[model samples]
Target: MCRNFVILLFFHICGCKELFDFRDKNKGSNCDVVFLSDSVKNGTITSPLYPSPYPARTICRYEFQGRGKERVQTIFQEFNLYHPRDDNRECDNQDTLIAFVQIEGRMEKIDTFCGSTLPRPVMSNGPRLKLEFHAVYGSRYSRGFKATFSFIQNFGIKVGVQLPDYPCAFVFNSNETRSGHFYSPNYPGFYPRDTECYYFFHGNQGEKIHLHFNYFDVEGVFPCEAKSASDYVEFSNFVSQDRKYERHCGQLGEFDIESDRRFFRVTFKSNDRLDGTGFNATYQFLDKVESFTTRSELTNETAVLKDIDGFITILFFLMIKLIR
Candidate 1:
């Protein structure tokens, strides 16, 4: 009986260890940076990228926006990387790794669209990354009117490694707005939609970094009562040097608005030569005016005139009319 009890205790300890190990692996890390609506009034940063000690092959996950019963479709129209290294093989396959749905444009002629990242080369076998999506509805609606959606952005790495210290990462910043004709048949009119971008870096304590930007507006129509716009920007970073991976997602949002024309900006400066960066800006305009014209006036600049001698002719026509 004594031997059996001892054996049972040994097994119990082993089981507890296994449980703890699994829990640790799945546990979410405390976000080093988080930017959401209603938080920042306005601001900017010099260098958006932060440092991380994890191998260059770490994978990160980010979730941006969701939909409810209202039947509004959220679309990611464009994705761009700035100063990206041509040597980065991962970026070369952006079309395959980053997925998006084009609502109304050159790509397709659909009212609604949805897509996901396709299969790609894995860079590392380290900690897997997942993204969860959430959405909030307006108060004017009834029960079940407001809802939140959740999804995971998974990152797979081929090569694995044991880190001596947690890795550091950087968050990109952006600002955008949606204003134009509401293509929705449910609600029609001109409403304004705006968004701000920010980022969080989570890894080793010393490796984390945070960057933020203010909100901006676009001249177009947006859904009504859609307060606080938010979404996640997901991507895979492949380290070709060591054949590793670093997937990342930095939560970003815009909450406070104190002006009429909303505009936001992001800046980055780095001494490290390896630090790569760039940005993409897009603007869509609808033609509503019937007549448009422009003229240039001469100030302190020299003016040149040409004289032409020809049969000068002036014609004027007048007709006599009696008041009726």
Candidate 2:
């Protein structure tokens, strides 16, 4: 009889499919802001070569689902600011303020929303800035689904002095040399031979500027060659005889830097030789960066060990049999 009752309850719940459906809909539409940074606090802004000297107070907020059965897990992340020195700085306009966010554990659904654009204007008399992201869901039985989002923000300003400009060049050498070639299937073509990319920002002489580098990889290749902490790097600034300040260098992997100059260059050199065969090295941008935090709560409802009516009925039958 107890088994029969349990079966009945299960069917009853299955029949009321709208119950879970309605619950899911309600939960999806709801947004719970889980974290808020104080209007004023000190934090560091990190980049490739330069680290911002002064800490600036930046505000952040996040929203998540709050409902029944289907638990909602929301994560909050903050990134160091990419503060450009001045309004006319070319580097400021070119560099992207990219950040990453991740969610871990069983997630029935997920979403992320971003504001229309970066340097999202600060509200008058308000210290906090707002950003939005949409939700993305994970597959069933996939308890932990991690996701990351990255974007660029431009701060219209050049905060430092303009340095002398330098001429930048890129030379590609393979077992074969072809003009106007985009990609190569050979060894030297695959691996970076030197750093030769550069960016220039407008500023005065002797002024200081900060550069930050955040690296990531998507191919799951560990110890891959690119712009990262392991590599030995250097930066310089100068003005050109043409009166235009420029930054220049050899071939370097994917990276971003902030400096005061009109001309810039990056040089790239491979650390080890690649096999002459196979497509081993492919030029690509680093993966997005991300971080996360989680919280969980249990409901007040308690589970019943057994049906009270069924227990009593069984006990009565057993007592009668014993008397007989």
Best by lDDT: 2
Per-model root-mean-square deviation over C-alphas: 24.2, 32.9
Candidate no. 2 TM-score: 0.18
Cα lDDT for residue 157, model 2? 12
What would the TM-scores of all predictions be? 0.18, 0.18
Which stretches of model 2 miss by more than 4 angstroms?
1-29, 39-133, 136-138, 142-245, 248-324
Model 2 residue 241 lDDT score:
27
| Alpha-carbon local distance difference test for all models | 0.19, 0.24
Residues 87-163 of candidate 2: C-alpha lDDT, one tens digit per residue: 53333332233222222322211122222122311110011222232222211221211222111111111212222
Question: lDDT per residue, candidate 1, 6-114, as tens digits?
Answer: 1111222211111111112122121111212123211221101121111111122221221211111222222122212445554342111122222222122112111
